[model samples]
Target: MFDMFKNNPISSIACVLPPALVNAFAKQNFYSPEQVRHVFTNELKTEHNIEYALAMFCSQLDFDALQLAVTYKELRANVAKECFGGWPRFNFDSLLDYSRQSAGAGGGFAGDGGCGDGACGGGGE
Candidate 1:
């Protein structure tokens, strides 16, 4: 949108928008069409301009709670490494500790951890 205004500043749609709002967004320095498309699609949830789709689907046809826990642990570790620059202070074990404490303190998982097997007892073992 900034490029849209570079040629004719006064007649641009950007100019018609509230100046403060326009200025605030401009600081992000988004020059690529991909960046603009992602921001717009997230805000609108229609993905009109994006060409690619990113999705992760896990179907529990045969897996149990222990298997699901392993998947969650791997995903959390990978995200922390790739997106957060490194592992966070809390890892899978720590997360399990927190969850168990939460459950012990009156947080039940839909009356039995949502698994046929009773609520899991802490860590991702």
Candidate 2:
């Protein structure tokens, strides 16, 4: 599955994402880079949607929300550079913000605790 993403625009982003998140996206019919980009850039149009999707992903994958949030933050620049040509023009921030809020409220992501794993590196705020 990882090998399949290597040939696309989201290669860098996909490489670092939790396998569950990648699989969740795949299950949602987001197989192509363009479709995935559309989800990041367009499909999630509101704070509610962002929060809902975050919660859904966490629930579905039993993944740590905080870890996912940290991963998202860590991959922001790569997503922008590799997929959007240095353009950070997307609603991904809303998703990040909502994820942070959800994590804070729930005390953590579903499975793990937080971003201390070091899997997430500095990318953007």
Best by TM-score: 2
Give the whole-model CA lDDT for all candidates, comma-separated: 0.28, 0.34
How much does candidate 1 score in TM-score? 0.19
Q: Candidate 2 residues 93-116, lDDT tens each?
A: 323432343334421222222223
- Model 2 worst lDDT run, 10 consecutive residues: 106-115
Q: Estimate each model's TM-score.
A: 0.19, 0.27
Clashing pairs in 2: 65-109
Model 2 stretches with alpha carbons more than 4 Å out: 1-4, 9-64, 68-70, 92-125
C-alpha RMSD of each candidate structure in angstroms: 21.1, 16.0
Clashing pairs in 1: none
Candidate 1 residues 10-93, lDDT tens each?
A: 112111222222233542222233343444344335543122111011112222232332453454344333222344443323
lDDT of 1 at 114: 14
